[model samples]
Target: MRLSLNPLAFGTAFALALCTSAALIGSGPAAACEGRTTLAQSYVGANKDVKAEYVYCANDLRSDVSTSTGAGSDIFARQNDVCGAACTTYCWTPSGGGPDPNDCTVIQDALLYDSENTGPLFSLDPATNTSMIVMTYNTCQTYILDQTNSSLTYCRSDWATLVNYIAFNCQATQNAHGGVCVADDQRWYIQVQHS
Candidate 1:
């Protein structure tokens, strides 16, 4: 007799494997439903874990999505639109700065002179700020807004640590422009207009 199993069994196994990989990739506290769009889909965030993946359903596929990692809100809305099945992921770390002397000042000067107008890593609203920028010099961090005291803050432990790293290594003056940190809580959030 030949050993042949039902096709359904193979399909189920495949699905389970995919789910397992997705889970390993860092989904949210909840697992995503089969074929359903959700925030828990694999994706990357502004975290120190370089192996992290920023995955999610397409904007056309899902109106909401997020991940366990802490990424920038400025990027999240765009991620929904372009996060392929596997999602966009990358590894990044700051380097090449002095030991001290003028840490924040060095970074602030770079921001003002670099022509990029980088950002303010700190925030006035902790609840809203989820990401922090890297500092190039002594690396003392600051913010355009101070989220260290906000109500909507949802950043995770690792995320908070990452932000702290940015703050300590960057400049407070940089926080005066378009690049402000927004805290992500592993849950999909909708963009709200400011008054």
Candidate 2:
């Protein structure tokens, strides 16, 4: 009897081994977004065109404000106080400026927190997956919040720098794991993942 090895099976196994090794090494790109630290670091490291400060903004502060209890208005108003004159209540209005729901308050609060902190703010959420990162560049800032169990990545601004930063970081991280990143409707999707 003769023994033969299947090329396809062998190749798949080899790729899996490589991925497992890469993850274990811990020196290469992360296997997934994981948390705010990984996301913030990757974004800042991969993007150099924008001179910005990136930091993690845990959802604790936002969590206390209940959108269902009609506290959203109070919360937004407080955020507006933080943002001062730059904040606008009609961020989603067509006549205001496009359809981005993230207003100046969101960006300003993130930037303000970044300026006051030395490092990323750790999340208290049990999942530890729902987190955000604030990137402040020039006069404007934006938020990149990761959705739980969703491939749809959201960014606050339409600025080219902000958009490119997210796309570049997502693609780079996914590529390291043998995946492809695609951007559509301001959301990034990873089409493939290493088996």
- Against the reference, the lDDT scores of all candidates come to 0.25, 0.28
TM-score of each: 0.20, 0.23
Most accurate candidate by lDDT: 2
lDDT, candidate 1, 1-195, per-residue tens: 899987434533442332222111111232221232222212112321111111222222111233223443545433332110111111112222312324433433343333223232212122323222223222233222111222222212222222223333222222211111222332222110111
In candidate 1, residue 91 scores what lDDT? 12
- lDDT for model 2 comes to 0.28
TM-score result, candidate 1: 0.20
Error of 1 at 113 (Å): 1.3
lDDT of 2 by residue, 75-176 (tens): 432322110011101011112122122322333334334333523232212244434444444433344433222222221222222222222222333323
TM-score of model 2 (CA atoms): 0.23
Q: Identify the runs in model 2 with alpha carbons over 4 angstroms from their true place.
A: 1-39, 42-47, 51-55, 62-126, 144-152, 155-195
